[model samples]
Target: MRASLSIVSLLAGAVAAAPAPKIPFVTATDVIPAPAVNARQSASQACFVIGSETLPKEVSDVAAALASSVTCDKSATTIANVPDVTSGSTTFSSIDFSQSSQTALQFALSKFATANPLADTDLQTFQDMLDVYQATEAGIRSVGGSLAIKVPKFFLEMQVSRIQTAQGNPPTAAGLQVDHLRDKVLKNAPRESKDLLDQVTQLATVLS
Candidate 1:
């Protein structure tokens, strides 16, 4: 009976000592829908029009002119009077600004890229934009909430290195702006989003 008791004790001790199973970390890609990803891509491309060198000077000038005409009126139901551009075969006429910010940005990029082959700088910019978006999206999705403000904050934090590499200039001003915006937005976020933001912040700490 003593021997059996000793064996049982050892088995119990072993079971007690076993480590708990680790929960898997959710990545940014895990949460971002395919449409969001595409939208971001499009937005990145659209932003390229502003500074692309591959296009003719006249075309770039026209793009610059048209950009000023596109107002950022979020309260409005639609973006009014978006310009169009025709590239080799694709023609992008108008983009609905009421869509996700990324989607709106994509409309801009598509219009810009339509006539202009993307320069090396433009490609780098797109990649930088994508990296930040993915990282932020992953953080937001991993924790599961509305913490969208965290996305921009995380992007600004993570994008500095990429922007420096791609543009030869740090995004210090832009980062600060995003940080400030995040702070302001966080104050208005719902309880669930705030909670998710905390989780994402923790993940960011680990990632950093």
Candidate 2:
């Protein structure tokens, strides 16, 4: 009788120690979508009217002209609550502008190469542009911290310079303006470049 009692006690203890089954809660499917800039508006803003087939050897000029035309209007929405978006296991507070810029530059370079395949001179220009890009990236990385603003200005100026070089002319006054901004940002970054890029990328995503 004592052995049976002991066995009953052990079974009761084991049952008490067992974890309860998990219960799942149902969620509504009507999740709010992220704010976005209309594709038509974004494309219109980025559109360029070029006459030549080649990636205007003067890439800087082309880029500057393109930049000048961009107007962040009503259709251009910021991707607010971007922290809600997750990448793998992590949720980002802002967009990665530098990475996006790098991507854009690479795409631009590739497009330019495709457009100017027959122009042997443009090949050297492309090489020089890549060199400048490498130096600029290295410069920003070495400086660190708020010194990152230099990246955008440098990128903008490089875009202008490339177009100018392609057109057989030196970078214009506007390119110099971007260069000045770059110098100031490099000397005193008001905010970290990485942070700035994050914000910019988040905003740009609305364009997508």
Pick the lDDT winner.
2
Per-prediction TM-score, please? 0.24, 0.24
Give the total clashing residue pairs for model 2: 15
- Backbone clash numbers for all candidates listed: 8, 15
lDDT of 2 by residue, 1-208 (tens): 9999999999999999999899976579666678875433332233231122222224433333333332222332222211122222222112334434454333333333313322224434444443333222322232232324344435434444444444556545763443443453344433445655343333222210
Estimate the lDDT of model 2.
0.37
Q: How far is candidate 1 from the true structure (C-alpha RMSD, Å)?
A: 23.8
lDDT of each: 0.36, 0.37
Model 2 segments beyond 4 Å from truth? 1-68, 79-150, 172-208
The 10 consecutive residues of candidate 1 with the worst lDDT sum are 111-120
Model 1 earns a TM-score of: 0.24
